[model samples]
Target: MHKRLFIPGPVEVREDILKKMSTPMIGHRSKDASKLQKSISGKMKKLMYTDNEILLSTSSGSGLMEGAIRSCTVKRAAVFSIGAFGDRWYKMAVCNGVQADKISSEPGQPTLPEMVDKTLATGKYDLITITHNETATGVMNPVEEIAEVMKKYPDVVYCLDAVSSLGGTKIEVDKLGVDICITSSQKCLGLPPGLSICSISQKALDAAKKVEFRGLYFDLLELYEYIKKKDYQYPSTPSLSHMFALDYQLDRIFEEGLENRFERHRKMAEYVRQWAKERFALFADERYASNTVTAVKNTRNIDVSELNKKLGEVGYVISNGYGQLKDITFRIAHMADTTLDEIKGLIESIDKIIM
Candidate 1:
């Protein structure tokens, strides 16, 4: 039986979107490739709510996350962690030999605006990275509030990891003063994994020019300049398959209407969160709960593996908690093209099995 995915990523792709991946190969250097990429960029700008230039990479969202930190941090970086993914960003900075400090919040909480204001007040860092939505703990940072705090420090290059939230929620990159906003095809974009995308501000590009040893392949400056020079062609042989699917998927997204899509995700998330509260309890604070996924606390101490096995038998699958919270909490993702009715169905199955 083919189980429906209720996990965070690699979400259920529509049959039509899946077929787009099989599109005929195109020369990566050809003008056709440039046209296709340019078309995607124009649509992406509308989706991201930014006038900044768009960059696409064949690797996962981590590729751009690493690139943004390595290329834009001229002095040092302050990474705010609301959960596992945020910590991973800090680790990427460390592994790249970039000077960085990790400031973490307790799990199930958010990286508050006050935390950002206090950290930036010291003037010790020139770059800051914030995870907009964390799948592990199902916490969504308050980017609007944080954006207000960010305005206090004009020189800081603000990098945001919207990998799991971008398409599911509204993230105004330009209004938030985000120098780089990164996301992947797998999560809320309703596409298969492979390509990662970002909107890079002119400020970020200028910051990258000052860094001397920014790595070659993931170099933001190199990628930016080449795309401008070659008219949207990537320095590396891009993932034409994913590009085809993404280009088609963006059109589908438009047809659905962005506001309608976001509202659908919001309704699904609210339903799941209410169900969790009534039964198992929520792991993250309700005020900061995510619109894409909900982390339910396992108050009943049910065997999560067994529950997943039962769900699989019923043609559905969810996710176990991530990292330290594993088994203590279970996550039900409501992003991508999942409808409120489908979310209710998954909850109904779980209720039948557990109760």
Candidate 2:
């Protein structure tokens, strides 16, 4: 069954974008490749709302996330968790031997601004990792409010995991004071999985220069030097396939207009939230809800597995709870190319099943 993905990520790719991925293989070092790479960076800069240099990785968003922390955390990091993804950032820091501590908000809660302030004011940390939108809990952290606190700590590097929210929201990367805003090709970007992109500020690049083991392949300063000298190309052979698709898809996103695209995502998300509240409940704070997916509490305690089986039969699929919330909550993505009508249709069908 060609079950439509209402689950997060690898969300139904547009056929045209898929076709672009099949484009004839170009030598990674060829002029064509450089042109494509350079062009895509410009487009991505516009999309991310940043003037900083953008780096492309052939790995998932987590890859760049780990790279950001490992490469830039020269002193120490304060990693904050609002959900599973944020916690994973702290894990990434520890595994990389980066000195760090973890702070967290209750599940279904936003990581409060005061918490970030208290932690940063200690002067023991020089880098911070935050997950902007957590698919696991359907919470969007208050990035703007956090940015206000960041202004006080000039030396601290601000890194964000925007793996799932980049294209669906107005992240304002530079404005948000994000030194490295990491995101993936899948998720809100509406492209297939493979490439992870990051907007790297000069601050992060300088920080990477001081770190002893910034690691090859993902070394931020190395990537920057390569592009500066070689005219916008990766130090390693890049994935031309994902780049072609992303390059094309970013145009489609702009065609939708950035604000308009963000609005569509917000509208779809609100629609789902309202629907979920009428029947069950939204898992996170209403004020901090995600604009890409909604995690609805399992108030009815119905057979979620059975519900999925029935949905699969009808060519539709959504996500059950993530991690500890499994079965206690369910998630439905409203990101990428997912439309209002599609959202309405899915909700109507699910309503028939549950109501």
Candidate 3:
């Protein structure tokens, strides 16, 4: 049986969106390809609410996250972590030999604005990365509040990992002063995995120009220059397949309305949280709970693997708690095209099995 995905990413793609991906291949350098790329970028601007230069990479969001940190950090980077994804960002920095310091919050907590302020006050860091939403713990950082703290350090390039939040929520990239806001195709975009996208401010591009050894494939400056010079074309062969689907998906998103899409996600999230609270216990801080996924504390110590097995038989599947939280908690995703009715049905199914 094909189980429905209620996990964080690779969400249930609508049949129409999947069909768009089956579109025949086009020459990456052809005018038709440029037009498709141009159209997607324009629509992405409306979705991201930014006028910054948009870049697409044929990799997951991590590719851009790594590129942003490696190419733009002139002095050092302050990475704030609330969960595994944030930790992964820090790891990317360290492995790349970038000078970075990790400032982490407890598992279920958030990276507070004060934490950002304190880190930036040291004057030793010129770049910062914040995970806007961490899937592991289901905690959404308050980017708006953190943006206020970032204003105090204007020279620092601010990066956001919106991998799991961007399309599902309202992230005003320009208003937030995010130098580089990264997101992937799979998460909230309701598309298959393969493409990574970002809105890059000129400040970040300028910083990238000064940095050396920013490996070619994911180089921010290189990618930006290629897109500008080639007219919306990528430096290497692009994922035209994903781009076609993304373009179509963006149309669907806007047709439904961005606000309506976000509201749908919020309603699904709230329903999941309430269900978790009534049965198990909510793992993340309620105030900062994610609007895409819910991390429920396994107060009753249920065998999550067994639960998933049972749910799979019924054509439903959620996620076990990520990383260290496995078995200790469980996660139910409500992002992408998932509807409130679908969420209610999943919870009702769980109730039948658990109760």
- Candidate 3 lDDT over residue span 87-106, tens digit each: 99999999999999999999
Local accuracy of candidate 2 as per-residue lDDT tens digits, 124-159:
998998889999999999999999999998889999
Give every collision pair in model 3: none
Score residue 204 of candidate 1 by CA lDDT.
Answer: 90
After TM-score superposition, the amount by which residue 295's alpha carbon in candidate 3 deviates from its true location, in angstroms, is 0.6
Q: Model 1: runs farther than 4 Å from truth?
A: none
Indicate whether candidate 2 or candidate 3 has the larger TM-score.
Answer: 3
What's the TM-score of each model vs. the native?
A: 0.99, 0.98, 0.99
lDDT of 1 by residue, 195-229 (tens): 99999998898999999999988898999999999
lDDT accuracy of residue 183 in candidate 3: 97
Query: Candidate 1 at 321: error in angstroms?
Result: 0.5
